[model samples]
Target: MDIKENVKKFIQSELVTDRKFADLQDKDPLISTGIIDSLGIMRLTAFLEKSFAVRIHDEEIIAENFGTVESISALIQKKLP
Candidate 1:
């Protein structure tokens, strides 16, 4: 699957307790909407690093980078060669 789908899947399966998370749009606001919390972001950062083989720098762990599946996918794309 693509990065966006993978990200959405990760959020759905691991981060949020809400099953409706599976229906969030690609560009939906995960954090702002309370679908994922601060701890969830940390766990998601780890998942991104391991799953995508991308090193998520401290400065990169912001809303612009991890706000949505689209943003996360964009960050991963930028990290990859």
Candidate 2:
């Protein structure tokens, strides 16, 4: 699977259990929509760090970086190489 797919899968399988969010869109607002909170972001950060072997710095953990699946994927992509 790819970055967006992995993000969507992780969000669905871990953060949320609602059927409505099973097909989370890439542009969906994860933070503003309440799908992901502060704690949720931390969990997501940990997951991303471990899963992708990328180190997310403190300055990078912002709404712009973790706003949606697409944004998160972009952040991960930047950290990858």
- TM-score per model over all chains: 0.90, 0.92
After superposing candidate 2, which stretches have Cα over 4 Å from the reference? none
In angstroms, what RMSD does candidate 2 have relative to the true structure? 1.0
Residue-wise C-alpha lDDT for candidate 2, range 1-81, written one tens digit per residue:
998899899999999856777778999888767889977888999999999999999999988898899999999998887
- Distance (Å) between predicted and true CA of 13, model 1? 0.3
lDDT of 1: 0.85
1-81 per-residue lDDT for model 1 (tens digits): 988889888888887787666687888888777976877888888999999998999998887887888888999999898
Q: Which consecutive 10 residues in model 1 have the weakest lDDT in total?
A: 15-24
Off by over 4 Å in 1: none
Judge candidate 2 at residue 42 and give its lDDT.
Answer: 87
Highest TM-score scorer: 2
